[model samples]
Target: MKLKHILIGVGVLLALILVLKFTGVIGGEKTEKVTVEAAGNKKVVETVTASGKIQPETEVKLSSEVSGEVTELLVKEGDVVKKGQLLCKVRPDILQSGYERAVASYNSQKATVASTQQQLIQNQANFANASATYKRNVELYNKKVISASEFDAAKAAYLTAQANLASAKENVTGAKFGLEQSGANVKEAGANLARTTIYSPVDGVVSKLSIELGDRILGTSQMAGTEIMRISNLSSMEVNVDVNENDINRVNVGDSATIEVDAFADKKFKGIVTEIASSSTSVGTASTSVDQVTNFSVKVRILADSYSSVKGGAKDLPSPFRPGLSATVDIESESLTSLAVPIQAIFTGDKEKSPSQAATATNDQSQDKQKAKLNDKNIKQYVYLFDSKASTVKKAEVTTGIQDDQYIIVKTGLKAGQEIVSGPYSAIQNKLKDGLKVEKTTKDKLFSADGKN
Candidate 1:
């Protein structure tokens, strides 16, 4: 009977222990633990990231000015050339024939001009002789020495000569005009012939060559000509990146940038913002929505002096970087020194009222107004301040200014050295509320240990 009593007592003790464990009577209520940080003054640098390709600052694409088959290709890709260097030659047979015809026409016009001038001189001489003869005849008629019919015939002869002279002068003017027209035609033909022989207009490297021997190209006079090749001055380079519309306003000419190319994995190039587009480029169109993504093109000129000194002192790099290499740029848009906290610490909702309070106070208009005032979207940015004495957190509404990769600038509502809950994102974003019991812990302790909180 005593053994049975002892077994009963042990069983009762075990039941009591299980009840206390399940009901939290022995360990007490568990408080949600969170990492906290002290808001302090620090420099917050704002940057905009963009991807683009490397291109020569001075690049010229060459195209055919006259349509013809490329008969002679003198330069290939990667060949360095100087101004006026012969790059290629197109088949000049057709152009030569047209030029010869123009020359013949011009010569013919010149001969016609000469003939008209000679005829004009002869007509002037005839007019002078007729005038002298008419004057003599008029004087003789006035002296009653010549017959009336003869005087009238002399007057008619002089009028005919004057008319002929006028006609000859007009013919000379027309012939001269025709000669000028033919001369212009000849010049045009000559220009066309010259166009068949392509010459480098600037000193550059032949970065791209699209035409081989015997390839036909179109002329630009009629349409956009076939792009035969590209010549680029590789000594100067630039990166063309597209900036999103939201960040474009902060970017300006002369802003400093850091450029990284895919080819040079370990090196970073320095650049400056050289150009910004005035208009936005549409990246995509949504069929069912009014929202569209737009980007503005920005040009960053690589500083040669700065680029020469890479991370390891510019060793093992190509003499001139090739075009079309993938690159990324980070533009330093703004910087400020202000009281700040980790970006994760700032939450959007009101931390002053718990959900239960909000639900219970719905019938009270004054409480509703207070909730509405706190829930206003315009001033919703806030952080949780840890009340050390009460061991609770209170929502402190804040005005934020700028942010860097990890931290944000607090423009108002928070002071330097004030301790605030930093993370365990869920606790601050969803669970924790005003007057909630909490325990302070470091992020490392909360995340590294498996059973701490």
Candidate 2:
């Protein structure tokens, strides 16, 4: 009789629990929990990021101007060099023969000029003697001392001597011209031979070497020759990165940056923006055509203090960084202290309609016109404005300035100390409408000054 009474009591308890659950008692509705914090003044910094290679501030490529077999290579890679130092030499067998030929030709032409000059003097003496004889003969012929034929012979002889003198003067001028031409040829031959002996044009370290002794190379006079080596000023280093066209406009000369080199691992170097390209790079390429990536070349110089502690080259050269090392740069464009909120709180939504949505349902505007209109007033930025008394959230449009990693500066449409939904990103993004109810938990940790969760 006691066991039957216990079974009846258990059935009655289950029925009462089911009744409460089905009615408005338990598990009735769900409310999303979100972290809320008041908007406050904080520092906001805007930065642009790009990846590139580290290179020297000044790197000179050495090429052979005359094609020949490298006979002597005095320097090796990583060797510190001085200005006007002999670096290498090429086999000058054919070049030396050509140079000797040019010198011989020049000497021959000079001797010819000297001989022609002596001939001119001799011709002048002959002309003077013939004139003296002709003058006497003319007087004698007028006095009938000699026949007209004799006077004619003397006159012909004098005229011939004068013509010979004039011809000798012309020969001397031609010979002088030939001498100048030969001189120029000699200089050209010397230059060709000099090119076989390479010399350093600047004081730097040989950062690269492409050839060794007895290597045949091709060179050119009209264009750059074979790149035999490179000399770089390693004390000064810079990172060359390609920035997207979208962010290039924000980067300017003298902007501060932080550089992260892959080889350094965990260490960041300070840098400054030294150059920003005005025009776009790599236009109409296959990759760009497919992906529509437009980039501009930017250069950032690494400050000396950042890498001063790093070891130098074997020769005590100030060269800790190597060319073509992968590096990333973050250029700080702007920083300011202003009223801001958590970056998660800022989001984009459908732009506000000018009239009513129903009124614009049948609007007939061209696609281009509609696109122009949309771009004129770009995507509206908004923050969820929390109404404390009603326990509801409303979207408030805001003009955003710059943003750091964690916080975004709100230019207008919100005031300091105003409560806003700062967390539960999904709820703020998709679920929270103008009149949607929310349980605002005042979690100051969400928007801490250190930006910790």
Candidate 3:
């Protein structure tokens, strides 16, 4: 009786286990699967990716023409100023004093000229009087009515007067020349003084101001000094990017580009390839110091119409885009009217595989197996098409064209309207066959393989 009870208990436990397995309380195999259909459509696109910043193409920097202490800053940074507007003023006191001294000297020279003219007239009058006396004396002597000594004395007096007149005329000429020299000095001093007041060179906003009140500015000379300010046209902008030697050939004038600034997160502006540097402009650095690596600068111009759209009006972008703000850009080098798929879809057979594990098979057999493995479908890029009537997958060979990271253009051997398997490749690898019958499984049946109902 005890043995029979034990046997009955074992049978009951087995029965319960079977029941649990059937109810999905235990693991089991999945019978059905779910599938997605592939649809073909034309995707028109022109896209590329680059990085750059928005900037004023004609950024006018306001710098001092002459060195002086900064006496007054007329405008602060971000002040919208017009062309020829006074933005700042260097200390003009010294310049003014110099100019005044120059004027005084000029006046003094003018007075000297007048005095010289008066002296020249007086000298001429005295010479004339002496000549008249000499003439009278000569007449008296010639008529024998006066002594020879008196005539001689009159002649000596006339000669002395003539010498004095010549000397006076020379002094007058020297004084006049001195006056002209003083006048020129005055004009030069005035020009230097005018240079002290800094002015806006263009119709732009004051983007920068390097001086506060009392900042000494070293004028233009061998040792260039600090700048007063920078003015830029807020409306106009440009981007400069360095193109690699490999890509420089593709980049040309008049190509299209897109720009995005980090400051303005939601904005995208259109630009054009306006200028490409003819000569290479690359400064070598430590990392790039390795011989033979080189790059060239390329400048792009922003289209006004596109900028307006990006700003969402004409006023959003800050005047003279702040330098050092990060930006991204994309230049369209080429485009084609063709069908494309994700680059991940195309797999190359060139990828190397890890060594296989030890098997029941020997070295010679393993070598043979490895040789056969070369012909495996792991490498060749293939697309599986769904045969609607047969309900099976068909392999299609393909040729490919240009690929940007996201998508690749299909060159040939794949037609539109044909559904291709995009996933579950491993599961269907051997079980799937051409003209084989199939039906998509429901969600419940699909997860059944993992023991979930």
Q: Write the per-residue lDDT of candidate 2 for residues 329-373, one digit (tens) a residue.
A: 999999899999987677677533333442344323322233233
Root mean square deviation (Cα) for candidate 2: 7.5
* Model 3 segments more than 4 A misplaced: 1-48, 111-180, 221-223, 284-288, 291-293, 307-324, 339-342, 345-350, 354-402, 408-453
**Residue-pair clashes per candidate:** 0, 0, 4
What would the per-residue lDDT of candidate 1 be over residues 290-387, giving only the tens digit for each residue?
47667899999988987665544223223446788899999988889879887768877544345455444422443334333432448678889998
lDDT of each: 0.84, 0.84, 0.67
List the candidates' TM-scores in order.
0.84, 0.85, 0.60
Candidate 1 deviant stretches above 4 angstroms: 1-27, 283-289, 311-320, 350-379, 450-453
1-453: candidate 3 lDDT, tens digit per residue: 999999999999999999989986677543324253453544433444556655677777656667778777788777888777876777788779999999999999999999999999999999999999999998899999999998899999999999999999998999989999999999999888888876766787766677788888888745555777777776767887767665677787899988877777777778888888776655534444456556677777767776554433325345325655667778877777667654433433432232233323453554344334322445455555666666666666676655453455666767766665543322333334444445554435545653653
Worst 10 residues of 2 by lDDT: 366-375
Q: Decide which is better by lDDT, 1 or 3.
A: 1
Model 1 lDDT-worst window of ten:
311-320
In candidate 1, position 70 carries an lDDT of 88
Ranking by lDDT: 2, 1, 3
